[model samples]
Target: MHISEGVLSPPVLITGAAITLVGTWIGLKNTKAQQVPLMAVLTSTFFVASLIHVPLGPSSVHLVLNGLVGILLGFGAFPSILIALLLQALFFQFGGIIVLGANTANMALPAVIVYLLFKKLCISEKRRNRIIGGFLSGSISIILSGTMVALCLFFTGSNFNHAAKTVLIAHVPIMIIEGIITALVVDFIFRVKPEMLLGTEH
Candidate 1:
């Protein structure tokens, strides 16, 4: 779901950069010193997971894992995702440097939102509830990210309406795939390493 460079207007790009900077600052400030290692691991996980793309009609989709990051990291997901995106842009050119902030914000904001909404369920003792939380968090994150991407494109020009729709539609399977993967991962972590989740208080 990376938006290439030069596709967005200057205002949108500038606004995105400013918002991401503030968000990353807040994320870093709130993240516990003890959680830095976990954050780094999750950042690498996101960076690698998104590299394996599945071909779609003309475009392709990849595993974002943003939902899992959000569930575990909360607002801290912003900085973690930003770092991964930066590497992807610099090393693989998966996305452009110009749109880095917009892409980071678009993906990370939903993660934070889902984390807040589903944090309780994710940490619940019941397996069923945690599973539901993971599925919803994973699925909704992709949906929201796709919508955010479309909205960004919408602001650029009316010609992008069809492209926006296509992007959203192509990600339907990704939503499901991410949902299942997130549920499995969350369940495993809860059982084997509950402290890894946000609000666990070590």
Candidate 2:
């Protein structure tokens, strides 16, 4: 969800930027030189996925696939998401430079959380466990991200209450779609390119 510029309070924007800075630093630290290329590819995928979104009041609805990216990239998702969002802001002007941090934090934080919470399950030996892990990661990340976006708006002012609720409600369908997509993608990757997943980096 891309929260438009000037919608958030200054404190919220600053907090988001600070959080993203730390997350990106950790992401880069965890990223091996060998994974750089894969990181770029996933960044591109994330960039393209949100290109055709339906705008809600302060945010937008679209396929984030953050959980998919998270399970694969782990902490690497921070930099991946930041770069992609930077390009989107620069080229399409989807979100402004001022709001970039908040936007990045809103999405990437959930990705990191997903990785922390479910990466082990995603890389499990059993197919069923991996599938369930993938599904949860996909679905829960959306809920987390949507909640974050909603809170950002809600904290901005009472005037944004409706918009905040709307943002959460609109993403319900996307959560399910992302869950199914992530499940299939994770299972397919486990079979075709296992090395790409987080726990398999070794």
Candidate 3:
């Protein structure tokens, strides 16, 4: 759900840039030296996951894996997502430079919200609870990101209203797919390496 450069107005772009800067700063400040490796690994996961796009009716969607990153990184997801988006823009021009902050905010904000909302459930000792948390977080992240994209488009102009609605509808399947993938991933990681699940919020 990358918003292309020049698609948004100057005011929207400026607001996104300012908000994202604050988030990135907090993420950088809160990131611990020992956690750098984990952050790098999560960033790579996000970078790779969003590359393969699945064509939908009017647009294309991809696996953001933002929930997984959010659960594992907390506020750290901001910087991690920013770095991944930067690489995507630099090499592939996926989202472009001007809209980087807006795209970053769209994806990373949901993750941070998910972290706050479901951190305990995700890290719970109960497998079922963890799975439920994972599923919800994954699904919700996609939905929220789509909403943010729509909002950005709406703010750009009334002409984009139809496009905004279509974006949300196109992402329905993606939300389910991501939910299952995230749930399975969370379960596997919990079983294999429980300590790894102890994120920044813990």
Candidate 4:
């Protein structure tokens, strides 16, 4: 979800910027030379996926293949998503510059969470477990990101309560669609390129 500029308070803005700076640094540090190209590809995927967004209240709804990015890149999702968001803001003004950090944190933090929670299951020996993990990773990451967006609005002001609820409710359908999409992609990767997923590279 892209939170518009001038919506969040100053404190929230600072907090988000801090989180993104540290996260992006760590992500860059963790990234290997060989993985740079893959990182670039995933960054573009995120950039394109989010370009087609439907406005929902103050924020917007769109496909965020963050689960795929996270499970594939781990901490690398931070830089990958950060770059995508930066480009979107620079070119399309999707989220604006001031609120860039908040938007990135809103979207990319869930990516890191999914990587930690579902990476092992996604890289599991059993096909069924991998599918389940993929589905959950995709679905839960959306839910988590949506909720974070709602909270940001709510924290900004009580007037956004309605918009916050709408944002969360709107994400339910996206979560399912993304879950199915991610499940299929993860299954294919397992068969054709299992090493592409996190924790399975070794």
Q: Candidate 3 vs candidate 4: which has greater TM-score? A: 3
Global Cα lDDT for candidate 3: 0.87
User: 1-202 in candidate 4: lDDT tens per residue?
Assistant: 7888899999889888988889899999998898798789878977888766755557766778888888888888888888898898889878889898888888789989999999889988899998999999999999999998999999989999999999999889889878987888898898897667634465
Candidate 1 overall lDDT versus native: 0.88
Prediction RMSDs, each to the true structure: 2.3, 3.5, 2.7, 3.4
Question: lDDT tens string, model 3, 1-202?
Answer: 7788879998888888887899999999998898888789879988988876756567776778998898888899899999999999898888879889999999989999998998888888999999999998899998898898999999999999999999989778899888888888888888887788874245
**40-154, model 1: which lDDT tens digit per residue?**
9879988888877856567776778899889988889899999999999899887788899999999999999999899889889999999999999999998999898988888
Report the error of model 4 at residue 17, Å.
0.9
How high a TM-score does candidate 4 get? Answer: 0.91
What is residue 96's positional error in candidate 1, in angstroms? 1.6
lDDT of each model, Cα atoms only? 0.88, 0.87, 0.87, 0.86
Candidate 2 global Cα RMSD: 3.5
lDDT, candidate 2, at 152: 94
Please list the residue runs of candidate 1 whose C-alpha ends up more than 4 Å from where it truly belongs after superposition. Answer: 53-61, 198-202
Q: Give the clash count for each candidate.
A: 0, 0, 0, 0
Please say which candidate is ahead in TM-score: 1 or 4: 1
